[model samples]
Target: MTTTTPRLTGEYAIDPAHTRLGFVARHAMVTKVRGSFHEFEGTAHLDSEDPGNSRARVTIKAGSIDTGNQQRDQHLRTNDFLDVPNHPEITFESTRVRQVGTNEYHVTGDLTIKSTTRPVTIDFEYTGSAVDPYGNLRVGLEGSVAISRKDFGVNWNAALEGGGVLVSDRILLEFDISAIKQK
Candidate 1:
């Protein structure tokens, strides 16, 4: 099968204010908890001619986790969890991208969280591109991936009387990214 060529263009930086790195997890096996990383940075190489050749890298400050509750956030940063003191950042570096369909691709990369590096693949969609009102060209991408929290060193949990656990292992990561092309 012939792959469509994409036009390689300028560098782009993620607009932190407009880009949100969020996650959701099942809470108590009946509810969902949503949260986001308040401090992070990312860069993208957008290629209009070869979509598969495009790339992205992201760095997230471990201490920037916020779930709207101070106590919960503190727990997440403890040694039993993210261990922000030891592993201060979570990062991702793309290794390859393969187009699955129009505007869709499988992005495989090495994701490091809390000192553990694992291979993760995110199903990503290119949501089209346009020139913004500020005269900056922007590209959009959205993706989601599910990961096991334990695999990343987050292994703390509390046993419940109902034979369940207080924390769920599965974490759903969602990315809504908007990047401005550098002139």
Candidate 2:
């Protein structure tokens, strides 16, 4: 017989300092570039009795995109890419959550980028839960989802001399989230 672990029910605010909002994209069709956003905020409300009742939301500052190279980062914020001047934020709001397996969940949400909104489903694993030294309750979750850049209106690309595009259309969004349960 298998025993089920009870879910932790509460409202939690994502800890930006301990959380990583990162992404991976193929560069030049031969290499992968990893980058992360430095500024973002998110919250999650979990329902212990009904996981499907859980909800989450997040907002990221498009200008905070950093891939180590200053020139490349700046280019990402321009009209050819993110167009941070016009679309300053990328947001996500969960519409549904379902348990797919032990410690795993499928979260469906609306992701908005640039001027487009698309539905995305991210698979998340409940890594763990614990009490911090500061006497705070915390939960950890890890998840990722792949999205098409063109679907979000980010259509800029360069052709390589030998053929193929400079960047891949697929982008992987990763989350390593640590959230503190509110009292």
Candidate 3:
């Protein structure tokens, strides 16, 4: 017997209602804080015949960051952090996509945050593909990458009374994407 995988070749737009662009960071060297960007849009062009030909682009509104805390969310948009008024958008543009495993891909891209651009790679697992109730062909993927907050010029922290810093330098970016193929 032989089996074949379904071709996922098409231009897809990310469904914000089914996608999550979140981040996790350590706070006070004790616990972790998680947040998600509520306003973002992305698109992907997948070439099943040549995975390396795939491409992706995303733009996140810096002012839409939410942590479930009104005060903290406001603080995050200030000059001490995102500086939303100055750098209103965070963006990512894929430079290359390579398959490293049967269902895993390493996507290397340029991530721009607060006017600073850096190269970052995320390892994504192809979760699955399905047809939604709305009759849309959808594809799912999950990925995460750890990066230094300071690398993007987001270096505002206070010293703890006892030890360590108020905020961790390392941040973990997580993605749960559901993209619908465009006709």
lDDT to native, each model: 0.86, 0.92, 0.92
The TM-score of predicted model 2 comes to 0.96
105-150: candidate 1 lDDT, tens digit per residue:
8889999998899999999887867778888877778999999999
User: Any idea how many clashes model 3 has?
Assistant: 0
Residue 171 Cα positional deviation in candidate 1, in Å, after optimal superposition: 0.3
Q: Which stretches of candidate 3 lie over 4 Å from their true place?
A: 1-6
| Pairs of colliding residues, candidate 1 | 5-49, 6-48, 6-49, 6-50, 7-48, 7-49
Question: Which scores greater on lDDT, model 1 or model 3?
Answer: 3
Question: Deviation in angstroms for 49 in model 3?
Answer: 2.1
Model 2 stretches with alpha carbons more than 4 Å out = 1-7
Clashing pairs in 2: none
lDDT of 3 by residue, 81-136 (tens): 99999999999999999988877899999999999999999999888888899899
